[model samples]
Target: MILALYNRQLVEKRSDEAIFNELKERSNYIENDIQSKLLEKNKISLTNIFELTGKDLGISFTIYDNTLQIFNSMDQYYKAGIFAERINPQVYYNLNYLSFREYTIKENIEEYVFNSFYKKISVDNKNYILAVNDAFNKVRLTFSTSDLDVLLFGIYLLAALIIILISTFLADKISSPIRRLTKATMSVAQGDLNVSLDNQEKGELKDLLDGFNLMTNELKRNQSELAELEREAAWKEMAKQVAHEIKNPLTPMKLSIQQLIAAFRDKNKRFDEIFEKVSPTILNQIESLNSIASEFSRFAKMPSYKIEEVDLANVATDVINLFTDEAVDIQLEINDQLPKISADNSQVRRLLINLIRNSIQAGASKIKLLINHENNFCNLVIEDNGKGIAPEITDKIFEQNFTTKTSGMGLGLKLAKRFLDGIGGDIQLIESSKPGATFKVTFPISQKNSFI
Candidate 1:
């Protein structure tokens, strides 16, 4: 519709301008021809000058004498004598004042019916008013609401539809590769490092697909290498820790045995007493070795996640009850109607116990637990007035066997992170300006209750 309107407007303007220029040029030529003939010492009239064209001109004219008298006339096309009763006073008025060039177009009631252009021209001091009009009385068809315009409009609509289809085809062709690339990227993110795409189309985009395939290949290779290196390093660390810890008790046990042997050789009457004193030392050292093994075994071989709807508030309450008799002050703040999360029941309990125990052992006098919802996850914020973790080790605090104090296996927060990972949750140590440690544990809300 818009195109049709624009085309119509353009054609209308062109037609009007063509007609105006044609009329102006033809009238100027006729006037100059007459003036030139008069300048040539020829007794030429307007009719003889117009006939000199030797062909039928598309202009009709009448020349007026000094008193506005019709000196001669010729109608090569039409509108020949219509101006006999109508001549401009301006031409005579201007001619009287010796200003000879006066011109104007007199319009008919209809736009394209007729237009007569009259002018005052003087040649060799001979003055006259020259009235000229178009030879072709052609009426331009209306631009709006015509049968031809309707046909053109139909063609315009057809062209528009064709363009739409072509562009749509091109868009789909362009976006198909991008869509595949996006999906492949998501696969890599989800740990499928072997993802790769075929370069179906040839363009600059082929380079993009090739680059993606190369990147994934490198990632898969690098990940395999990293895994092998990590396994070797982990085994080495574990072996060293086991050997050092076992050697601790083994040394004391060997010392106690030496003391027993001395007593036996001396025939000491207190040999039985010496044996009794050293026996507990040997048993205690054995027990320490067993404890060390058990902790490492648990850390290395965590159980598979048993996902279930677990009320976190209830789990936290139960874990809090276990440490209620301790010196540390425990404060629990929970919503009255707390949402349940999808996680292993036992893991939730253990996670809470581990964090609370950490706060107590950190010399915290007061511990705060705030349970709330964040988007599609449950946020369990644990704040403690303990000595905040040293900034240097904060980044490594989540690693297996990483710790700051002299204690048992450093697996509390590591276990928490593992459990959260299994349950599509997360744990982070919040950085605070205050003098206490803050940990935020996130558990995904149960799928049935969560919107996303």
Candidate 2:
């Protein structure tokens, strides 16, 4: 539609110039013909000259000498004899008045138009109709062109506005999704795991959202597990120290009761032998009580390490040997290049023993101890081929009083971890379940001097 409008405007503007040029040529032709005929006939009067020129030249003619005016209409084609005879002389007179309004004479016969204006002039005693058409045609052309230019400009402006609006709408539509995704990403980065995208577009962006969701979920889960593990570790350390402190006073009481029972067992004290027999029984009970109290006291004491150079492999070997009497099968793999660690030898040995014993108690048939040096630290890993712990219970293994063993005070691994911690080391339940458990003990090089 716009193209058509522009074409129409162009044609309208150019048409005026075309018509004016055509009319100027036609007027020149007419003037030349009139002069040529007048010179040929040597006529002086306008009225007589018109009749002669009209007859000889085969074109309708017009001549005016003030009151005696003459005029004739010629078809656009000016086909000489054919159009001259059919020409309306009165219509030509009306054309002279219409011409004053800047009009063009066009006909289907010529498929063309011409624009000009008419005026009367005196040559000698006769008057002639002189067409002064240049400025007249120019003015008509100018007005026509101006109107066309206005229409074309209006269309261009409208098109520009439409294009601008369409571009703005599309830009917002495309950018909105990206903006939403950006905000969602920032929220996720800031630890909001529940952020979701509303876009259902099936493309790479949707895939990206899926990936982002997965990453956030994993991070949240890991963070939760880490917090829980820290709490368990803290509680385990506190409980272990408490138990260790509480076990100290019961040892001497158990011995005193046993000595009193033995004294009553003599023959001179037969009647007292009865009391002596009861005394030994009471002493046995006291000893048992004393042992229990001692275990608790030991469980509650916080480990204080004296750092020294110590061989982690020798400590691991001794821990394994400590459990050699058990029915469980054990294997030890210690790295020969294991660096001397700076830690309390006694605490490290206890850490290893606790882990090995825990694995054996978990119904593990074959226990594997791997000791190695890594990252300027000694790493002791005790793995058992028993049933692995349930995922739910594995995290709670380091908690005080949280135990899988019926025989333990539930402070073995707990205390071991505390002692390891006191020596700038850590004991971790690396893996576990009904299948088996693996405990890792890492002792730093700074504590190596105490171990030695």
- Top lDDT: which candidate number? 1
TM-score of 1: 0.42
Q: Which whole-number lDDT from 0 to 100 does residue 278 have in model 1?
A: 100
Structural similarity to truth (TM-score) of each candidate: 0.42, 0.34
Question: Which stretch of 10 consecutive residues in model 2 shows the poorest summed lDDT?
Answer: 100-109
Which tens-of-lDDT digit does each residue in 337-358 have in candidate 2? Answer: 7777887766665566556655
Question: Which of the numbered candidates is closest to the native, going by highest TM-score?
Answer: 1
* Tens digits of lDDT, candidate 1, 111-191: 545555656676557766766555333334444236547778789889989999999999999987887787666545544
Error of 1 at 149 (Å): 4.4
Count of residue pairs whose backbone atoms collide, per candidate: 0, 46
The local lDDT score (0 to 100) that residue 311 gets in candidate 1 is 92
lDDT of 2 at 270: 58
